[model samples]
Target: MARGHWLDPLARKVLQAMGELPPEPSARPTPAAPPEPPSWVVDVNRASASQWRQLPGCSEAMVDLLLRLQRGGVQFSQAEDLIQLLDLPPELAERWRPHLVIHWYGDAPPQPPAPPLDLNAAAPERLTAALLWPADRLQRLIQERRRRPFDNLADLQERLCLPPEVVEQLIGRVRFGERRPGPSLPPGC
Candidate 1:
């Protein structure tokens, strides 16, 4: 027998003695599997921020804003209402609105007849009320405003801790307010 072949048996014995060998029993118990994801019924008008994030194409930021708006008692008579609050593209809003399901807390209240918001002059409360932002979020936004004036609806959203989707949803609804005309003709002769 070759010297190298003779050493193989000794190596095997050494490995076995050291408890470095394979398992004695081939069968081993497997770990339990994880549970499946919950099937959530989305109520666009009432779903929490976290829940909104679950929707297809909805981002975490969007969900946050949506929840903030819902908590603030903002009404969604039509899904398009969200477009103004978030500053999203009209095409995008139309594309995503169908996936959203709006729910009324009770008998759907009669749509209030009100004029459009004046973004330049509206207070945070008015803005929040219009956008459906929760009280706490609205409060936070107001506090943030002391440091800097809001440049646009997006600026309000950034200060309000809103989700991107909610911001996107409101884009269409926001009215920047009509701009003042430039200096009149110096001399109308």
Candidate 2:
């Protein structure tokens, strides 16, 4: 009987000359890494505001924006599409893209052509059409907008003298981007 070499391949070969197990299968091919799951897949049309909030790196404000877009018949076909349409910050968008997916719905009804209204820019008619505000209030808003553009959601509220509760109610119902008569301008512009 003979002891076997555990370390040296040559020694193992020598042992094999006498009779021993074949040299360990040449370094096992490195096992391929497992495929990653599509963890970021989000059903844009179906996800609730809360669900949207659950996406990695998403804030409450981001969720609101997403829901508003969804309500406006803006269907997200891909992460890139959502990133471009939302005009998300490049770094933030890139960081979150891996976890996002625009889930498909089979035989879903066609989306409305109209997109959600931009709080900073929507026409009085579009505002009326999209929101349930009274004509008089909408008129005041349009007039106020002309005097000085809304600074942000807060500015819109302040300009309109809306209570905090009212603003809260309007959260997912409106967006604050692209001023009317100024497609390139948002709150600051």
Candidate 3:
């Protein structure tokens, strides 16, 4: 056997007694297994822009887009849904997988369509046809509007001395708008 392969007499005796020899030590230490990522799970469905910004690779534009979509009643039910919504790269999505959590709170109720007629801006003839008001009442309404447009049903009712039943009926049929600017029409015009 070569001198390098030969073990010391005492060491060989110990190895023989132990039944095996330990492996030779290397010059460099063996590397340990990679550490797991820290848990920073965030519920994307309800996370604020700042929270979204806290993620490793999230961008300001992505946060803004998320907020806009949220405001428009969009809900993301999964990380994949968000990835698709923002068109995120697979690598970025994978990077975000451990930190992102999705929670779904059922879809928001639909909003009712706006009333077609604006009480503050409608013509007297239109008001007469829609509201079926007497000519005198319609004239009074126009005069009141000319002074200052009705802000809402309460304001309209108060200014015109309309009954509760009239205001109630106007609820879904009428809407008020900001007062129009410029010269007011002359009385009885």
Candidate 4:
């Protein structure tokens, strides 16, 4: 057959299979790669929950806390404040760092920190008001406290399987008193 003949394709395959010719490029075309998403940046002090949610790894609880603080007139002056306030993991904070910006409206005097609520001694009503926990979760907390006071945040988290954001919100707002022993049994049955 001539070089440009119809049998050339078959001959090329045969030669390639026998190692007499180099393999031909695939007849199928490679698909084009998908385009990357557009990058976004948000001002930490001014961003709404929806705006903040666009960033990777931001949870609904975190956004809720952020908006709550924002509504209370809290403003972030630096990246560290957002990371520290939200108790973000180092890796996650790093991932979000690039997308966060700070724009201070004006300097304000720092307010005195609120006294931490005692988890062991506080009444259920007070805890509910302070923690804003769901009714069932608050009930679990009260019940757990009645059984034995929590030693610390870690203990509470492990006992309740609390989400990291909840534990983080409790950091300076709640304190666990020293555990008290249970009542002694009667002298005799």
- Please name the candidate that would achieve the greatest TM-score relative to the true structure: 2
Off by over 4 Å in 4: 1-38, 108-189
The runs of at least 3 residues in candidate 3 whose Cα sits more than 4 Å from the true structure, single-residue gaps closed, are: 1-37, 107-189
Query: After superposing candidate 2, which stretches have Cα over 4 Å from the reference?
Result: 1-23, 104-189
Per-model lDDT? 0.57, 0.61, 0.66, 0.71
Instruction: Give me the overall lDDT of model 4.
Output: 0.71
User: TM-score of every model?
Assistant: 0.40, 0.44, 0.39, 0.40
- Tens digit of lDDT per residue, candidate 4, span 56-165? 88899788767755654556656865776566899999888878887866654233236778899999889888888899889888877777777656557656667655
Clashes of each: 28, 3, 0, 0
Tens digit per residue, CA lDDT, model 2, 39-80: 556576677877777666677876776665454434544465
- Candidate with more favorable, higher TM-score: 3 or 4: 4
Q: Lowest summed-lDDT stretch of 10 residues in model 3?
A: 107-116
lDDT of 1: 0.57
- lDDT (tens digit, per residue) of candidate 3 on 18-125: 758654444235899898875677787678988898887788878876765454444554565566545578888888888887776765322323444888888888
> Candidates ranked by lDDT, best first?
4, 3, 2, 1
lDDT of 3 at 174: 66
Sequence-dependent TM-score of model 1: 0.40
